[model samples]
Target: MSPINFTHILTQAVDELSESESYKGLFHQHTDGNPLPSAHALCNIVELARAIIFPGYFGNSTVNSRTVTYHIGVNVERLFDLLADQIWAGLCFGGDGECNACNEYQREEAAQLAANFISRLPQLRRVLATDVEAAYNGDPAAHSFGEVISCYPAIRAISNYRIAHELLLLGVPLIPRIITEMAHSETGIDIHPGAQIGSYFTIDHGTGVVIGETCIIGNNVKLYQGVTLGAKSFPLDADGKPIKGIPRHPILEDDVIVYSNATILGRITVGRGATVGGNIWVTENVPAGARVVQRR
Candidate 1:
């Protein structure tokens, strides 16, 4: 065979791929001087957040009453810095090709959003404490709150979810999804950042759990591994694309328990104090205090 013209072929391939039509809708053209969001920075932000929320368990092992305030104050300051940059990047990324004025506005907005998120840290910590307590108390194997915070995948996933959810609520674009996806990738737990989860939420053996967008889970809800709270079908627009921002996932009221591998679909409600047994598939509304299980 004749020798192949490798350089010529590569040049042709690059030329073809670089064509505007070929790369359109697939490429993000970043504006000059605008920083794109960094996954590494976000990872650090999440770590700092965890450290602040659970001081002794995560960042500083020697934290006590004397040093606790100092540790938290330092971490919070650092978190604000990192989170603000990422939030700015997210805004820049999703902005209509940036103007200098728009970029400046986004920068200011990002700082405000970061400060707001930081202010919510106390409330976030309170909610996470409930989650930790729920995990430790729900599982017989759990020995301590430290164990739940340090060891449980649910806590890790839920913390990310909580953080991301708050960011979503703050109107920061793109970054919240990225943060939750980071946790999902690490833990095999898929929680959409848009999901609304109340206090004392615990997921046992959390692998393969999927909580879809628009799922409203109330307080004291315990979900075992492999449970799926997903949409049955999406409502499409006139163009046949699935409509955005519709509430389609199931709602679990307070004190509900869904067992492993159970699949609950649609906009149904799992009423308060209900129990859904393992491997069951539910599409209808479950009554309050009822038990749902697969029939023999």
Candidate 2:
């Protein structure tokens, strides 16, 4: 080789192997076979769940009452398998421990949990039906139930929450958060899987809505955009660190409606049929049927 070529090659090698330089590791710490979740798949699952819950409204083919049963049966079965795969990915992602067994064994356990969650879909739909009705009746601009069902972010968010909540109840780890987060990104509504909400709930223009963990929302409660049912502040532990798991969020009794931009803090309760006006702040319990509108 020429003198300049040889010198250049030697210098490049020394620079690469220098003390301050290093090689990028090609091996990853995690190489599990579980499918990595795609936001697309979660979105697809949301759409599929909606179609399964209310037949003929979603999906490609036309559905009739006779075909409805078959359609739901098929979708639920597919949903169970697909969701199980995604949930398995989530669990593995979150250090839920390794399965020392063969691939078949892990896949089998996932299938079982997925099947268990799928079987509960009927009950989930029943709760969501009340949500749809509440949204439709509460909004006069809604032309029909079909319009509300077809075109409401609230329905989509609620559907994702119902599905995720069921998984959380079943103690299926990791995947529930991914499922709910997908809805949050799509709908701008943040309802944590740990939040305990009851039937006939509705949220209008639900962007920036924060329903924290331990929040107990009663039946017939409606929340508008920018509403917050959050803890006043996290109380410090004996070590001066934030404590966990006490009831920190506000509770709304039956028939309460909180309008846009209202901030309700702490473990307080707004009593039955109370109307909290827009852009107000609430920290204490509101009595029944009380209309707390903004002054002037």
Q: How well is each residue in 14-105 modelled by candidate 2, as lDDT tens digits?
A: 98776342633432245556556567777777788888888888884688978888888888877876787776665555343343323666
Candidate 2: stretches off by over 4 Å: 1-29, 95-106, 238-241
Candidate 2 CA-lDDT value: 0.83
Minimal lDDT window, size 10, model 2:
93-102
Worst 10 residues of 1 by lDDT: 94-103
Q: Point to the candidate with the largest lDDT.
A: 1
lDDT digits (tens) for residues 1-296 of candidate 1: 99876998899999999998897677776667878889999999999999999898888789999999999999999999999899888877754444233467888899999999999999999999999999999999999888888899999999999999999999988899999999999999999999999999999999999999999999999999999999999999999999999999999999999999999999999999999999989999999999999888
Per-model lDDT: 0.93, 0.83
